[model samples]
Each structure stands twice: as structure tokens, then as C-alpha cells.
Target: MKQREFLKKEKEDIRILMKFAGIYCRENHSGEKVPFAFKLFDIKKIERKEIALCSECTRLLTYGLTMRLKCPHDPKPMCKKCETQCYHSAYKAKIREVMKFSGMYLIKHGRVDMLYHYFK
Candidate 1:
């Protein structure tokens, strides 16, 4: 894929991950959360968005983004369909939990558009 395509996919993936993290953190965790600062991939636009997450969710999002950036697939396959697993087992499980919960929450709240990604 071209650099432009890769960056577009990267940005989309980042947005999805952040959305999932934000939803999970807000619903499942409590306490004072801070707005996360994203400093990777030169995504200044994303950095400006305020995504408040607990520390654990922040770490998970950071790890997820790092793993995503390091993925070797050119046209990156979905993690579940990828032959090469990039995430550590623990992180993978955590991410699955977040995705599952957030996906269902979105669907329940009328985000039918996410069904494809949720079921894929």
C-alpha cells in the first residue's frame, strides 16, 4: 500500500482503539481520569482530541498503538485474521474484552455501523 493509504488506515485504527478505550474506561472503571496525550505517528490532530481514560486504559491504548505501528502486514489484516499475532497474550485478552464490551455497547445504543467491525 502507498504511504498515504497506510497513514489513513493507521489513523482509522487509532480512532477506533481510542473510542473503544474511552468507552470501556468510562463504563468499567472509576476514579479520576486524565486526558490522554497521543504522541506517536505525528498524528497532531488526534493529539488535540481530549480522550479521558484511567491509567490502565492509557497504558493499554499505548501498547495497542505501539503494536499496531509495528505490525509487519502491509495491508494489515484484522488482528483475529492475521497469521502473525503482534500482541502479547495478556494484552490481546484485554483488548478483546474492551472491543467486545464497547462493540456491544455501541450496538445497543444504536451504532449499527459498527456491526461490521464488531463481527468481522
Candidate 2:
């Protein structure tokens, strides 16, 4: 894929994961959305999604986006099926929990289009 396409895909994936993590966090935890926006956050290019998420989930999102931003793949494969894992073990486990939870939630809610690519 072209660089633009790759970037777009990365952004979309981030949005979906963030939304899913937000869903899980909202149901499983208690916290607030910090209103302060930082200048260094790279996710501005993607819309600032306004979902309410806990601080931990918020941190997970920052980590997740950072991982995506540094991805070495030209046309990235699904992270689950990738041969090389870039994330630290703790992060990998945490993200896997989030993804699995959100994947099932998405399937239950009929968001099959996203799953088609990820779970294929």
C-alpha cells in the first residue's frame, strides 16, 4: 500500500481499537477523560474521538498508537498473525485482552466488516 493508504489504515484501526477499549473500560472500570490536550500527541490527524474512557485505557491507546506509528511493515498484517512482535510482553498481553474482548463485543454487535480483516 502507498504511504497515505497505510497511514489511513493505521488511523482507522486505532479508532476501532480505542472505541472497543472504551466500551470495555466503561463497563469494567471507573474514571474520567482528562480535558487537557497535549501538543505532542500524534493522533490529532485522526479526529480526537470523544468517547469516555478510564485513564488506564487512555494510556493503552497512547501506547497502541505509538506502536502503530512505529510499525515496520510496508503493508501491515494483522498484529495477531504477525511473525515479529514489537510490543513488550506486558503490553502484548494487555492489548490481546483488549482486542479479544472488543473482537467478541464487535461480533456480538454486528460489526463484521472490521472483523473480516482482523480475524481472517
All candidates' TM-scores?
0.85, 0.76
The whole-model C-alpha lDDT of candidate 2 against the native structure comes to: 0.70
lDDT (10s digit) by residue, model 1, range 41-96: 55446544668999999999989988887788888887889999889999999999
All candidates' lDDT scores?
A: 0.81, 0.70
Give lDDT tens digits, candidate 2, residues 1-120.
223433667767766766677777876777566532323454445658666666777777777767776789978887777888888888889988888887888889898787775555
What TM-score does candidate 1 get on C-alpha atoms?
0.85
RMSD of each: 3.2, 3.9
lDDT of 2 at 115: 71
Best-performing candidate as measured by TM-score: 1
Candidate 1 yields a Cα-based lDDT of 0.81
Give candidate 2 regions above 4 Å deviation.
Answer: 1-6, 35-44
